[model samples]
Every structure is written in structure tokens, then in C-alpha cells.
Target chain A: MICLSLFLSFLQIGLFSFGGGYAAMPLIQEQVVTLHGWLSMETFADLVTISEMTPGPIAVNAATFVGTQTAGFAGAVAATLGCVLPSCLFVTLLAFIYTRCRSLPILQQTLASLRPAVVSMIAKAGLTILISAFFLDGTASLIRENISVRMIVWFAAALFLLRKKKWNPILVMALCGICEAAFCAV
Target chain B: MEIFQKKQRLPVLLRLFTSTLYLSAFTFGGGYVIVTLLKNTFVDKYHWISEEEMLDLTAIAQSAPGAVAVNGAAAVGCRIAGIPGVLASVLGAVIPPMAILSLVSLCYTVFCSNPWISAALNGMKAGVGAVITSVVWDMSSRIVRSKDPANTLILILSFCLCWFGGVNVICIILAAAAFGVLRSLHAKKGGSAA
Candidate 1:
């Protein structure tokens, strides 16, 4: 029953979410934290961070982590399938039909409108992450007093490399890991 | 419609699986990076999909549900072959994360206890935040450069709604879609890119 519920919840996430991975963060959070009580918001943010470190889709990683935490390996399998299978089925149907009517004006307009909102959703996810990463309580308002210099420095370095220099994210992440570990050791 | 031509059943599936798996494993920056790798292999290397078709597929992938990379692979794979191709592509996209995360989950409990490990994980969280910020900046700039005022307004409204108002994302998106349809209808008369 636990595994089945995990699968069904993630399947709903996979089916309903649009836009990109970050865009799906809120939905993932709502389902896991607010709706099911599977994980707390702090743990969800941690999972999101860990998911960011892992390869593959962020949504997939979250589903796997949450599933495993809740019900071990079989839970992981069930959750992953639930998250991906819906997309697989839906996209196949969409692909078959879309290829036939590629240029419908209505479709084009809808896509154009979606682009901006998608961008905003990603930004919202980023804001939530920044707060959680910096603040102790994971609350946006307490960030001023709870700020950690180490986190801010590492974040700035990552941003410069990623935004300005266009460094490889994997390399940046590895470096950030080493820097953080070293900082913590000292 | 002669794209990618005909291939025997088993080999095409194999090829799709291998290519997608290799691409997903090699890239870590998420959907767009995976999309680029797909383009390089399918469009540039194999000539399996035309450049325009790849763009269309990406758009469709974004507009639809699930991860864009998975959707892209399925859409392109379906175009190249058929149902088998979609299976191969999705499996290829999914397998890497499962394997990688399985290994991570094995250590997750152990890693959670150590303070040093926790610090590193927290630092990595910051890095992830930076990466997401950069991604949003890059994507937002492109849309802004499209010179559509409605795009800018929708973008701002969505951000405010999500950040301050705490409105449900799905509701915001639905509202934006309605706004988009109206914006495009108005643009048709004014004659600008919609």
C-alpha cells in the first residue's frame, strides 16, 4: 500500500507538471511535504539539493529519493516508474498527433505564452532554494540573521563560473564539493 | 519524410538506447544540455532529424508534461522509429538516474549523520541555486529579447504570483495561457511576432 501510494502520487506529478524540472519543484514539494507528509520542507529542500547533484532529471531524482526514504528500494522503483511512465505514454501520443499538425496557429500562440510563465517558475524555484540554502529555518524572512558566509561564497563562485565563464556544471559541482568539505574540515 | 530512413527492428532500438543513455550520462546540467547532445548526435551526426524538426520537438516537449529531455527523446525517437523507439529512448533517459541514485541512496543514511558530509551537501545546495539562477537568467533574457511586452508582463506576473502571492503554479500557468491566446490575437492585427 505504501509503495502503491508513492507510485500514484508521483504518477500524478509526472502527468500534471509542465515546463521544466525546476518548474516542477513546487508541485513536488506540495505533494511530498504538504499533501502526503512524506517529507518535511527542509528534507524536501535537501532532497532537491541532492537531486541537483545527481545526474538525470531533477524530478526523477526527487521521486527516487523520496520513495527510497519512505519505503526502501521497491519504493524507489515504484516511484520512478510512476513519475516517468505517464510522460512516456503522454508524449508518445502527443508525438504521433503533433507531427501531423505541426503548425497549428493556436498551438504556436499557446507555446509562446507558456514560455514566460515557465521562466518565472524556474526563478521561483531558484528563490526558494537560495533561501533554504542560506537560512537556517528555510524561511525567507530570517535570512539576514542566519546567513552563512561559506554558503554565500560558494554560491557566488558557482554563479560566476556558471553565468560568466560558462563552466561545466559537473566540474563546478565537484569543485564546490571539495571547497565545502575543506571548509567544514577546518 | 525520408528522415533517418528505414532500419531493422532490433538495431534501431539498440542504437536509440545507447545514444540516449550515453547522452544522459555525459551531461549533468539538465534538460537543455541533454537536448543539445541529442541535436549533436541526431541532427548533426546522424542526420536522423532535421534541425527544424528538433526545434519543434523541443517546443512540444516543453509544452507537454514530464521532463523535457525525456519528452525530447521520446518525440524524436517516435519520429525516427515508432513505439519501440519511444521505449528505448525513455528507458535510456531513465536508466542513468536510477543507477546513479541507487548508489547514492545506499549511502544516504550514512552520509546524513556526518557533519562534514552535511556541510558539503549544504554547499552543494548553494551551487545548485547558482546554477538554477543562471539557467533562469539565460532563458528569461531570450524571451525578453523577443521584444514582446506581454511576455515581459506575464513573466513578471508569474514571478510575483509565485513568490509573494503564493498562488498555485498550475493556476498561474492556466491564467498565462489564456493571456497568451489573447495577446496573440491582438498581435495578429498589429502584425508582430506572436
Candidate 2:
């Protein structure tokens, strides 16, 4: 039953998570924190950090982490499979059909119509992250108290540097972690 | 002898294994990051496809099922080396992460409750949030480049609906699709009548 639950939970995340892994964060948070009680808010936040630091998609990392926590190796396998199998199956089938349908007008039209919507989904995901970071869950108090000002500044600085220099994300994330630690200690 | 000869027809499985390893090992910053990396390798390095093809592949990968990074790799691989290439690249992308995460999960089970580790991760969360915000900003600018007032409106409305209204994303996607199709049909009719 636990394995089954792991599969279903990840399957839902994999199937519905449209924009990307970051976009899937709230959904995974809801599943692991609210519904399943598998992880605490702090731990979920940590998982997000660790996942980001690691090499794969956050969703895959979260699934693997939560699944292992809930059950074990078997649970990890179930969740990972649940997360990836849907895409694999879909792409494989699409590949088969694409060869035959590449020239079809309706398919082209449908895809063209979907483009803007996909862009919207991506943008909405960004807004969700912004809201969660700055405003959600009474973190407004921290911002009001001026404790979060440095953090915000760091964020903005990092954004500017990243855009201007095209620095490696891993390097940027590491530097942010170091700055965050320094701020907290001070 | 005949069976052995048939078995040697194509090294599909071998190619799949190689491609999967390559993607899984090299992909960083998750899927979006991988998309950029893929463009570098496939377009700039390999000349597997043109810039336009890369953009088109990204669109398809986003709309299709599974991880965008993997989907993009698989499609590109298929384009380059046929069905065998698809198998190779998808497998390459999936396996390493699975192995690494599996190991991390094991270690996490042991150290998840450690206070120092917890504190470090807490600090790291703030950083992760910042990183995600930066990525979103970059991607949003790219997506909203059309300068079309109507597209801008849809983009804003969609963001508001998803972020503030908490509507189901599938519904939002469907609404956008409906709007697009209807608008196109109206335009076509107007063009023909004119």
C-alpha cells in the first residue's frame, strides 16, 4: 500500500507538473507536507535546497527523497518510476506518431495554438515561486522587520550578476548559500 | 548462425545505454538548465539541428509528457540517430539521476535529523528560492517577447489566474487553447472575406 501510494503521488506530480521542476514545488510540498505528513516544512524546504544543488530535476529528487523516507529502496524505485515512466511512454508514442503526422495541418495548428498557453504556464510558475518566496505564509512579518532585506538584496544582486555574466548556476547557488550562512550568523 | 546474425542487425540497445549515461551525467540545474545545455551541445556543438529546430523541440518537449530535459534529449536523439538514438539519450538522462538520488536517499535516512545539516539546508532553501526566482525572470522575458498586446494580456491574465485565483492548471491550459483556436479561426474568416 505504501509503495502504491508513492507511485500514485509521484505519478500525479509527473503528469500534472507542466512548466518544470520548480513549478512542481508547491504540489510536491502539498503532497509530502500536508497530505502525507511525510516531511516537515523545514525538511521540505531543505529537500528543495538539496534537490536544487543536485544534478537532476527537483521533482525527481523530491520523489526519491520522500519515497525513501516513507518506505525504503523499493519506495524510491516506485516513486522514481512513477515520475519518469509517464514521460517516457508519452514521448515514445509521440515519436512513433510524429514520423507519420509531421506533415498534418491539424497537428501543426494544434501545436501552434498550444504555444502561447505553454508560455503562460511557464510565467505563472514564476509568479507562484515569487509569491511563495516573499509574501506567502506570513513571511511578510520577517520582511517588515527588516530581517529579510539583506536576503532580498542578495537575491537581486545575484539576479543581476547571473544575467550580465551568465555565471554557472551551481556557482551562483553556492555563493548564495555562503552569503545566506554569513547573514544568518551575523 | 542465422540467429546470431539477426541479433547483430543494430546496436540499438548499446546506443540507448550510451546516450542515457551522457544526459544523466551532464544535466545540471534540472530540466530548464538542461534545455540550454542541450542547445549548446546539439545545436552549437553537433549541428544536429538549427536554432529554429531547437526552439520547436523545446516547445514540443514542454507540451509533451515527462521531464522537458529528457523529452528534448530523446527527440533530438531520435532525430540524429533514429529510434536507437532516442532510446540511448532517454536512458542516459534518466539513469544517473536515479542512481545518485537513490544514494542520497540512503544517506538522508541516516542524517536527516542532524541539527547542523538541518540548519545548513535551511539557509540553502532561501538561496534556492532566489535561484528559482532568477530563472523564472529570465524565462518570462523570453516567453513574452512577441510585443503583441493580446498576447501580453493573456500572459498577465494567466499568471493572475494561476497565482491568485488558484485555478487548476489543466483548466487554464485548456482555456488558452480554446482562445487561441477561436482567435485563429476568426482571423482566417476575416482574411478570406476581405
The best candidate in terms of TM-score:
1
lDDT of 1 by residue, A51-150 (tens): 7666688888888888888998899889989988878887778788866665678667876777678667667767776787888777756546777777
Off by over 4 Å in 2: A1-79, A95-113, A134-143, A182-186, B1-89, B113-147
Poorest 10 consecutive residues by lDDT, candidate 1 chain B: B1-10
Tens digits of lDDT, candidate 1, B1-194: 21344656677779889999977764454676566567657876788776546655665576678987788888888888878888898889888887777777778656556777666666766766776677677668877888988888888988998889988766776787787678678868787653
Evaluate model 2 with DockQ and give the value.
0.30
Alpha carbon deviation, residue B157, candidate 1 (Å) = 1.5
The residue pairs that clash in candidate 2, if any, are: B16-B88, B20-B88, B20-B91, B20-B92, B21-B92
Model 2, B17-41: lDDT tens per residue?
A: 5644754554544564455556545
**DockQ for all candidate structures vs. native:** 0.45, 0.30
What tens digits encode model 2's per-residue C-alpha lDDT throughout A1-186?
999999998898888777666678888988889999989998898787667545677777888788888898798878887887677666656655655674665555444545555555544543443444454362435555535555556567667666687675445655765676565666
Q: Report the lDDT of model 1 for residue B20.
A: 94
Best-fitting candidate, scored by lDDT: 1
Docking class of 1: acceptable
